[model samples]
Target: MINRAEGAYLGAVRAFQNPMLDLLHKRHAPLVVSVLSACFTAERPNVSVADAHTQIGDALDQLRAAGYDESLPIGTSRDLCRQWADAGWLMRQVVDDVEVYRLSAHAVDALDVAGRAGGARARVSQSRVRTMLDAVERLAQDADPDALVRMARLDAEIRRLQQELDRIQRTGAVEEVDDEQLLEEAENLLHLARELPADFARVAESIKSMQRDVVTALRQDERPTGEVLREYLERAQHVMEATSEGRAFAGALRLIGDPQRLDGLSNQLDVVLRHRFTGRLAPQQRTELREIGHRIEQGLDLVFTTQREASYVITAQVRNHDPLRDRQVDDLLRDVMTGLQTWMPESRRGQSVDPLRRLPVAEVDHLRQTAGDLRPAQPPAPLEDRDDAVVDVTSDEARAWGGPHYAELDRHLVTLADGRSIVDVAVAFNAAPEALRRPVDLLGLLELADNQGMEETDELAFVDAVRPDGTRRRLAFGGVTTRMKEAVDE
Candidate 1:
């Protein structure tokens, strides 16, 4: 027979691995996956069977438009819904005499995975580094109860900052990142932003589960009320405090609620969006990001509500039994006994104890000396006299290299006949008055092909062009037709 440990291990592994993943990967299941993704990935609380069916049909249509010819019958969609309900990916309930589906915990986890997998790959960025540093500082302060431990961490951070400053001074300045690097970092930020909501949702679900377990235990357990309350309180504290995931979840909730952090995150995202190297996001990505943000906010609110409800329930239960009050009395007696044990002898009681005597004096002195030695030295003063001289340029000289004035070219091109080839326009431009034929004016003519109303035709023509330097250049002009308005008779 298999051992209990082996069985437990297998069970844990099974719980971690979603069977729906295999079903999603099966052939002919792409449409089903898309339907589930669209329906569950959204922030809606529930979807009726009719609505889900309609959504599936719409998804199938989209798939067909995207060149997938496989036909999905209505029966197949219904069967898929039934399968998901059976597999625990969806919970079905009758609402207003109509069946509706809400995503099960497994479904939510599956969707979270799908979202991250489909999103842009995350990259390390300066903002993320700063956030990490802030988290480390906060954790050090919160997790370490000893004052000396906190002092040591703070000292180390200070030294690290000093070293960074020294490195920057030696290097003159930080180098600018190239476009490729910026794009990678932006994509990474987007990935993390998308995942944030999903993470919050999972945390909220865990809290809800804990709440449910507490309620169930209170209702079903036959133990003494005080003992049960104590057990529940201990478990709740352990889940919300002792565990790393719990701590992280709590930290994330606090960060989410922090206005300054929210503003900083918003500013960072705005910068990423406005970056020259960051191209336009796909429609789906934009939608996903917006949905993620909305869902995260909603999930956080729900978590707070659940917590309040749990607290209310616990308070009511404790009040009914008065166990906590009795327990407090017991704790008081225990504390009194512990204090008696710690009471000094009559001879020693008269002597005053120094708080400093608690610490290792030699170690403290060594730390002080080491900290003094690690302090950064002051920089040398600059030279009194410098050979560099500043030069000023006249306005005309500055304007000379400004390159290309395109207003005249734009006005002339916009008034041209609808079907005129770019070659014909070029000839007309060349034959125009000298005042309109300035190199800067012709520069605007080249930009017409890129204009909004300009449509390229199959024909191509070679044209002679004059550069801003007055040099002759051969240019290939793709025949383009401009949309010109017809004059209406008065």
Candidate 2:
């Protein structure tokens, strides 16, 4: 058998290894504790990532200004927060598309420890002793194996309460608890109330662990999907029974699940706060009593949110589970791990390798889902006999209907030029060949002029042109004149 000293030594080792004790043993424990307490409160237990970073940075600056610089961590708020998260002091999660930071169970425990140690009132008090005694008595009465013994205990309690009630009614005088005792009891209750957040966090963390385990089992494909799903379903349905913390919280939830129950608690707290004894209590303690119901509600909300998220994850995975794909992913991951192991022994120290940032896009081809005849169901109608339908067209008429002769127009413009001379677009159009003098040719001349850096005139110009079919038309547009270039500058 181990001696008491050895047992105590082993216990200390295990306790020190816990994240909560680790936080308290930190080099800058005071900074961590004070900053966390100032940042998080019962009213706002979690903060958005940006807001948390900003608040922490401000707090750090304040500390530095106070000449506690040497006691502070050596980094920006963001870096420090990330470090804390890695060390299990904070829980970083995404809520409603926003990343937020909440005190982890370990952090909450650490804060509780710091708060208890900061004051002399945390020492054993009369109310605390009485509370424990009453709890033990209740436990013993409830756990008695003999029905007669349980009934006798209940009878004794009822008689004692009845005797007090009769005396109060007979005398018409009610005895009140002393202010000092009331304050002590109130403080003891607050200590217990302060632990709710840590308890809620632990339950949420437990649910998450169960969810992760179920997902891993699903991906392994070692069991049938139905079997795995059934196991998860049972676990989800009886989540409270999955862990000791959850089971205890489940009982507390049942007691306070009713809205009226919480309202009653709040009313009682309000009555207590109004007493003269409350005036002696610190402002923080007064607020804690008043907001106790709200604090419990917030903790419950957090736990419910975690439960819903876990359920959603499991449902989505079950709906989309693919054994073949899971096996493929596992194979690929194994290959990657093997490659890394092979390369590690041969690699140089401090050497780095670039990561694959993206995978090749999947290429898919359109496929015809149905078959249909390429040819028409019926033969086409014979061409209409139109040999004598339109016999009035001539070559000149057809040429008039065609596009402008740009080549002929260019040749005419070059021939009319007198060595880099400025030619008015209207004049050039009038001098062009008859076949190229269609109204469309006027637009071509304008385009060519623009290409040669034409100069605009304030006065409008008109172009007179004859179509190949002897049709005359007049086009009016903005004046544009260009300097004709020699063939060498073409």
Structural similarity to truth (TM-score) of each candidate: 0.46, 0.68
For 176-196, candidate 2 gives per-residue lDDT tens digits of 889889889988998989888
Q: Please list the Cα RMSD from the true structure of every candidate, rounded to 1 decimal place.
A: 34.8, 10.0
Query: Alpha carbon lDDT of residue 230, candidate 1?
Result: 83
- Cα error, residue 149 of model 2, in Å, equals 1.3
What lDDT does candidate 2 reach at residue 308? 92
Q: Judged by TM-score, which candidate is best?
A: 2
On residues 1-490, what C-alpha lDDT tens digit does candidate 1 reach at each position? 9999999999877765665564455465555556777786456756898898688767766766887665654454667788778876776655446778767655665665665666654556665676689779797689879988888888998999999899899998976778776655555555565445445445555666666666555555456666766876777667657555466567767878788987776676566556566466666655544454455566667556556766776677556645456567668899988875786544373476555546554634333344456678779998677456533445754544455546655556545644443334565465555445555555555565445355666788555655435566566666654443332111
Q: What is the lDDT of candidate 2?
A: 0.85
Whole-model Cα lDDT per candidate? 0.62, 0.85
